[model samples]
Target: MTASTPGGRRVRIALQLQPQHAEYRQIRDTVLRAEDLGVDVIFNWDHFFPLHGDPDGKHFECWTMLGAWAEQTERVEIGALVTCNSYRNPELLADMARTVDHMSGGRLILGIGAGWFQKDYDQFGYEFGTPGRRIARLAADLPRIRARLAAGNPAPTRDIPILVGGGGERKTLRVVAEHADIWHSFSDLETLRRKSAILDEHGAAIGRDTARAVERSVAPHGEPEQAGEALVAAGATLLAIGVSGPDHDLTRLARWIAWRDAQG
Candidate 1:
């Protein structure tokens, strides 16, 4: 979903409610607070086990929680940081996205990526293939996902924006230039500058309009203003901050929201 903008530049704030060691009530409330604070998007991770410190800590599934978020929150887009392609069939995942999009009045961002967590693959009995193989699968399935979404009954109210999250200089970014409406990555200022240049190169190679075709997003770890300055200078307009569930930190979110406002 696109955000309200000013000065002809798009600025969006996203908070990832990482389901590391959190209860359902905590997760639900975080979503509520995100909307209350005027965050543009609220996200959760798609994993069976905890991603932070504990492998066996409290957690939840991705799509189910998205369904709940769709019902619970009155506004604010919802999605996974990047749903692992190994978890479900591509068509089914597309249908799941459509369902959530409808449930949320089209406030859904379909963030997807090539699966990487070996532990998730091992514990869930999914084949943990080589990195090349995973990207190949992701590349192949992206079209199927779009086709399914188009064919599904009660289609999404809007073309649910597909977000491809990764910074791989080769295949991943190329796929981003081809398929994603939103491209998400993690890097410092210099790295983001270099990589954005490379992404433009790739988009040129593919004859895609990189400048206006895709929205650039980054994951910010520290103070939002500092991070936001670096990333925006590097051509990023969407900034995402992660807050683990059960202990959702609105402190950082509030700061980022303020920073986003201060930019105007």
Candidate 2:
């Protein structure tokens, strides 16, 4: 029921428990149920306001909740599905991730992205920069983050895996090629293939062996029996299922876990 099977192949399925319209207690209970159900990773999103449902719905801050999750779950990697780069200083973010990494005994995945969601910026008093500017900032900040992580007091429990989500291609894929331990894609099949090749090309241009080095990540499109094969064939080993708040449905999660198990 861990990530790895008896056949030596690993099936890494993640549940992104959307932090919207749900109380902390419901979220906490779901986290426990998910770990018990054998998800390889559990994720929450980085947003100050609800992305759906009521505009003024209940929501929790991302990093603080991650600190709680680090203590709550004994297994399953915990992180934001993608934290906004523009929200915090890169060095500070690095230290927070390191602290949570230690808190979770090294089970943190630093999933990051260029800032989106205009309302979050507007409400939280952060800049709502252009896409180019945002990504440029993320690109510039990654090295600083790495340097800070390297210089931290105790250092990370392990090389914390960086999962870079986008807002891909021209700028983002290149960043992923250079720095990311996992490259996430939620695009369709053709997009997945095309972008993946571009990601490889970026890796090659930089001499980084990206296609082999970065783990390909994707969310399931349909039934796991059907979607899983194609996704794996397309080189996505990580399946991140989005579970919206108020329900945090696990029916599909159970189905995918069943599919993953049958792979053995």
Candidate 3:
């Protein structure tokens, strides 16, 4: 949809095509179908195992899948739902993202978050540090990530967009204020509003106007015309719907896509 916020930003639709409990072929087909349907962005989660469905079900790693998507899809922007800062060294992650950005002809968004998922950590041999420690690590890594992106042998295809996912009022939002080009969450309208306000406060504290710099993103709960409209009114320019494995039915996704077209 092309409706702009008071700040003059248009609404955008994103699909989080979760990479779990499905074969790689199914996942790849889903990405192609979503792009064909005119989704503005496509995303896959960063996980070593299923977050839902059978515990040990089929799944794919995040970055590799994103690399594949970069080669496979053409119209839509792509990225991990939120790459775990704890999984790879920050510098290496930047290099990887830059490569994918080039592969996609400059359509990559680097969605990232402080690490979670105990199983991903346990299975990969990464320490399941306390939540505070993980956030601390993310805070320390953001600067290095930016630096690496700039210093890479060949820079990213463009100034890659940074999408920071998480709604922590303290560290996470503060970091978003400082570095994020997009701020993503699964929060409902009221919480989205509250956290956005807190994000502005942090931005002000840091002497930056985050309200303009960071686009607010939320996953609407109910009908798009209702819940999604509320979110847009509450300052979310990006509406993301999450679809997972197996069938990866897009009936609901079609409805949201229709709504976006209508708004335009």
Candidate 4:
């Protein structure tokens, strides 16, 4: 689905601040730089251990970092790329999202997904269910999250944009058609084109115009001009690039920001 905001174009830029092995100061500085560079959104992963290597490496909590970003950034929207459902109760997560939304002055995009990564579940003592079961839970919890957001004591200043990540053709895309404002995927160009077609089919089945229900997004990992042009042509409204580590690279991010500006 393609996202729109009163305008017809679907083009936005986001940067994922992957907290694999970085100190808090570095992560904070990277976020500031992303904001300064005029990126649209900023994100961090929601895993206890490092997803790349060294399971016992340094990492910070997702919501906490979001809170810090809320105070630190003035323009860029911030949230997890996809917060795991298994980590917290759905209602509580909604409350947290609402709080962050208000904290960021209605700039928080609540990105969530079915839980994956067994290391997180095993180490944290949360249940690690089968894929089908996990997706089922995610499907069920989305409405509850929406309900809780509405029922919260102080509702979010604005309706928080929901970003659902994953590319499961059967269940995930259908869920994206049904719930997500932005659908994020990690597929290459050919794969993204195929999956986007499938998502369009799913949206048609549900009577929701996929083109209006959600925005296509992906993580591009190369030169900004080339990657950005390719992804935009492939129906990706939001192009995300991940920056990892102790020394966060803002060079590529600046380049992408310049590209986005050029497109404008």
- TM-score top scorer: 3
Candidate 1: segments with Cα more than 4 A from true spot: 1-7
Residue 110 shift from truth in candidate 2, angstroms: 0.5
Task: Give the per-residue lDDT digits (tens) of candidate 2, residues 1-264.
Answer: 434423344768899999999999999999999999988899999999998889899999999999999999998999888899989999999999999999999999999999789999998899998998989999999999999999999999999999999726889999999999998886876788889999999999999988678888888788887788777777778888888778788889988887887775
lDDT of 1 by residue, 1-264 (tens): 332333355788889889778888888887888899989888888888987887799988989999999999887888999898878999999999999999999899999999788999998888898999999899999999999999999988899999998889999999999899988886766777788788888999999988678888888768975666766766788888888856788998888888887765
Model 4 over residues 1-264: C-alpha lDDT tens digits? 333234366577788998889999999888877887888899998999898767788888899999989988898888899899889999999999999998999999999989789999999999998988999899999999999999987879998999999989999888999999999987888899999999999999989988766888898867876677777777887888888888888888788777777764
- Which residue pairs in model 1 clash with each other? none
lDDT of each: 0.86, 0.88, 0.89, 0.87
lDDT of 3 by residue, 222-245 (tens): 888777667777889888899988
**How does candidate 1 fare on TM-score?**
0.95
- Ranking, lDDT, top scorer first: 3, 2, 4, 1
Worst 10 residues of 4 by lDDT: 1-10
Q: Worst lDDT window (10 residues) for model 1?
A: 1-10
The better-scoring model by TM-score among 1 and 2 is 2
For every candidate structure, what is the RMSD over all alpha carbons to the true structure, in angstroms? 2.2, 2.0, 1.0, 2.7
User: Candidate 2: where is the Cα deviation over 4 Å?
Assistant: 1-9
CA lDDT of 106 in candidate 3? 96
**Which ten-residue region of model 2 has the weakest summed lDDT?**
1-10
